[model samples]
Target chain A: MSLAELQRMTRGRGEPRVKQETPDNKAALAFLGPWLVGVVALTIGPMAASLYLAFTDYNLLEDPRWVGLANFTRMLGDERLHKSLEVTFTYVLFGVPGQLIVALGLAVLLDRGMRGLTFYRSAFYLPSLLGSSVAIAVLWRLIFGGTGLFNSLLGAIGIPSSTSWIADPDTALATIVLLHVWTFGSPMVIFLAGLRQIPREYYEAASTDGAGPWKQFRSITLPLLTPIIFFNLVLAVINSFQAFTQAFVVSGGRGGPSDSTLFYTLYLYQEGFGAFRMGYASALAWLLVVIIGAFTLINFWASRYWVHYDD
Target chain B: MRLTTSSARRTAAAAASIVVLAGLTACGTGSAPGAGSDGAAPELSEEEVTLRATWWGGDSRHPLTQKAIDAFEEKYPNIDVVGEFADWGGYWDKLATQTAGGNAPDIMQMDELYLASYADRGALYDLERTAQLDTSGLDPKVLDLGRSEGTLYGMPISTTAFGILANQDLLDELGLELPDTSTWTWEDLSDFATEVSEKSGGEVVGISALNNGYSLQLWARQHGEALFSDGSVSISPETLAAYFQQALDWTASGAAAPASHQAEMAGVGLDQTDFSTGKQALAFSQITQIPAYEAATGGATLEPVKIPSEDANEAKYSYLKPGMYWSVSSTSEHPAEAALFVDFMVNDPEVGGILGTDRGIPSNGAVRDSILDGLAPGEKSAADFVAAEEAYIGEAPEITPNGASELDTLIARYLQDVLFESQTPQEAAEAFIAELDGSIQSANQ
Candidate 1:
């Protein structure tokens, strides 16, 4: 139903509906009790505590001393924090879009009635399941080391590439970006579901109107898939912002080769755990939340222009 | 609708009050270290007590430590010890989190660089007041290395002197006798390394340039300064630049592995270092690591020589470093039991025999003498090197200041910049000093 029609209907019968729904309120609240308790105890509680900690000078071993805004001001002069921001932004700018393109392309390929669809889907999904794992990061290090499989393959073709992909500062961040892009399985699955929901009759209608595949995709599929694309875009942006494990494992926790692969979260970890500056780390954490929140909010605001939920 | 809204407001109010109650309870449970328990008079009891002992090492060290723990339990009978071990990379991060949570193990293995930090924060128990821990057999100098401010916070488990580890097979292949380390200067050593690299057809570098702060400390001492003194950078920027310049020259002269190769070898264990892997003729190592290098080379003859000095008979660069310490956590429920365990690990010949020198040469004179006869040839050489170097060894520098652990990585990062030619030695040195001073100041704050 359209918004105007629903609003008119609600105004006419809202009081009677509320009176009827009151009888079921106890059952509804009982069902929600577990979820409500969890939010109050775990999520909201820690978030509130962390928010308070962001303003203090806490070294974990000692009690937090309120230093008010000093932690935030320190960022103005922190060279490492600036470098981390640059690195994390670079990853998100390139990685998220690259991942989405690959995911959509794969989903389109699978949308065709290929044989053994389940097997192919699972095979493709395996990387996303294992992508953030320490084992995969270790495997990636082996694949990109000075005398690793990648160089070996290059040598087979007579190129003789001897550079350590993960050790060279020039190529270290790029290697991490490739690792992020390699895990496109989750978005691809979502794309596949979205594709399935598009009625086949729309395509048939387009075909009858003499629309070719490209034209149909541009007019029908593209516009219809915007909502799903926007959803994936938001999630990918947030995930890339918080990327840690790959860089941490690959760099051996020092964020070295000149700190080229120091993700924002990894740097925060180094400050909090490695340097024992918990207050500064807490401030950095809050800054990250603001940045991620701003990006997500922008994405939602922009979605109204393109996303189509109804015909 | 009105009733539902009112009920929702009431629910919100209840949650807010519960959260306030939770915050208050959490504040009450902050458990000040050593406050709840009678720290000075922890009673020894026949009642059953279990304690967690944590340390970091390779696969070999883990089993030996566990064996020692098992022996301690057998001897005490009333105490059950649980072992926690991790590789060095994740060890500090885990320890910090556990300590902050007030769940640190009863006994923890600690490094000198981190000893003062933990001790100053009141996370470590004062061994002098523990009563059960007997330190009469330990050298006073060695014991003092574990002290912060005025009190002993950790017990020295072993002492290892820093020196050079040479691959004898490669040295012999090149038909070169070991340089006379007692009189050789850095210049002479560089020449010797260049000759080795040339003779080996560049298959082996003469030396693997280390980005270690300990190595820098030795170099600084040779120039009659300390890397750190009284919680500040004590060495001049000129000395540091010259040290890094020497490393750059080694790379330029093909006496050290290329920058990319060195980066790959950074943080690798003894088994994978270039010297152990037969890719370098000499590498920086502690006396305690000689056995592990020998094992990695499958019984190849590896020898320890003194770290070369800058002047003839003027530099006292070598000192015995407490390999690591056995510390009792301030939060440990059984401080007495933990202290007894440390004493057993140190003085018990059976436990010493099981552990050997994996933790470095035993700090106790009796334990060291007892284990000497049973030592393998490789282990004997390391122990002998320590004995021979005793006359030349100087006073141990002050326990590394807080933030000193980060200096190693900072030095390595700048060293890489020098090797990669992104920064000159002078520039790297200046940046290093600035960064080190900044970290030290912040850490002190």
Candidate 2:
């Protein structure tokens, strides 16, 4: 029904103004109880605690000592801290693009309408489900280990290699990046959903105008998919920056091979839990908030230049 | 379509939530080593007490410890013992979080490096006044190893010493004979290792380079220095230079595996080391791991050879390290029961029989004598090796100082630089001293 017609029906041609019944506020709150409790207790409570802790020297054993900006200043001289930042940035830079490309490629292929659609979608989505798990990380370690399956695979094909990819300073980060790239299923799903939204009539119109598939994709699909692409890009970048489990399990928790796979989160964990430097770890966390915040701000600003809308 | 707009908004909302969640990754619940449960109750209560006694070891060690716990529970039916176990690295992290949360385990297996770190922070119970934990069975020197600032925070459970552990079967296969270990110098050891490597046709290394700080201590002692003295690094740069030079020499001569291979084996855990896998004729090991290594080697006979000296007739500087200790959490409500459990772990012969040399050679003489017949061949030789090396053993070394638990990590990183030739040995050694000194000073603050 038209909005005016619905409004006229509800208003009865403006004959009289009727009073609206108020919701049972207590009942509504009761229904929202679990979610409210979760946000307040799990999210807001700890967030406040960590904020206070960020400015103090909490070594876990004693009461937190106020250290002002000491923890932040310490990061300036901490070579390992800088290394972890570099590693995290490098990971995101390489990993996000690789993942989005693969996800988009598969999404495009699947959008062409394949048989066993459900099965193929589920199969492709499997890695993303298992990718961040400890079992898969351990499998990565074994697969890239010195005498691991990868080397045997190489050996069987008349190539001899003995590199422990996860233990090599030069190659360790690359292995983790590849692991990130391989788990492109979630973004692929998003891309697929976005693809379905583009009107078939638009493609028909474009095809009648002598546009080839590449030109059609460039002129039609690309612009329509911009918002989805932007969404996936930001998510992927943030997620990549926070990557921990694969690096943790694969590198045996020290982020070894001389800290090659030391994600920022992993280093924060080592500082807080391993060394009992909770205050410094809290400070590191806030620094990450700033870093992630700045990146997000940049992403939002950049979106203005490229994001398209039907309006 | 409205579906299109809602789906896009839904996806955007989902992505935003992920970002929000990831931003809160710093919100943590675990705690660390600390003083707690400083409750007014000091006396053992008649009430039913449930104690969480935790330790770290391989899967094999778990059942043995559980058996001991079973025996303890049988002895004191009113007191229930809950056994918690984890791997070595994760154990500290767990204990720290628990203790910080004021819920530390009642009984904890402590390491030398971290004993003072915990005790000095008041995280551990002071056993100085506790009469429940007896020290009469342990050597005076060995007992004193647990003391920090006049407080007895840990009780020595067993002791072990470092030395060259040779895989005898590998040696036999390679047709190599080790020289008399007691009289052999570093040069002699190197030559023998090179011969083994050559004989094995590069299939095996003589040893994996010791990436840990323990070997640094052994090397320093041989040169009349120590890794740390008076709460700072006392090992001279010259000693470090020569020590690193030896690693380079070994690698260049094919006596030790290359840096890449060594790095590979480091992450594979103790059971997969070159010596454990029968890929090396000789490797650095402490007496505590003899049985485990023997098992890892798939039944290869391991023979303990004394660590080679700078000069055969010089001071041996051999000291027994109290391999690990039993500690009580200050936060533990059942301190008396925890002490009793530690006492059983050390003094009970049946418990010793169950643990064998798994922890190390038993520290209590009576317990050691009683368990001798029950030990596996691998463990028996380890016990015997300690016995035979006793004549040359030096005075027990001081307990590790606070803020030094991560020295092994620091050393490992610098040692990698040395192995990878990223920095000159002298340069890395100087950097090591500066970083360690800063930490020790700040830790004292």
> In terms of lDDT, which candidate is strongest?
1
**Which pairs of residues clash in candidate 1, taking residues 3 or more apart in a chain or in different chains?**
none
The segments of candidate 1 whose C-alpha lies over 4 angstroms from its true place after superposition are A1-29, A205-211, B1-43, B174-177
- Alpha-carbon RMSD of each model: 3.6, 5.9
RMSD of 2: 5.9
Model 2 bad stretches (over 4 Å) = A1-23, A152-159, B1-42
Clashing pairs in 2: B31-B96, B31-B97, B32-B96, B32-B100, B34-B123, B36-B331
TM-score of 2: 0.91
Instruction: List TM-scores for all candidates, in order.
Output: 0.92, 0.91
Clashes of each: 0, 6
Model 2 docking tier (incorrect/acceptable/medium/high): acceptable
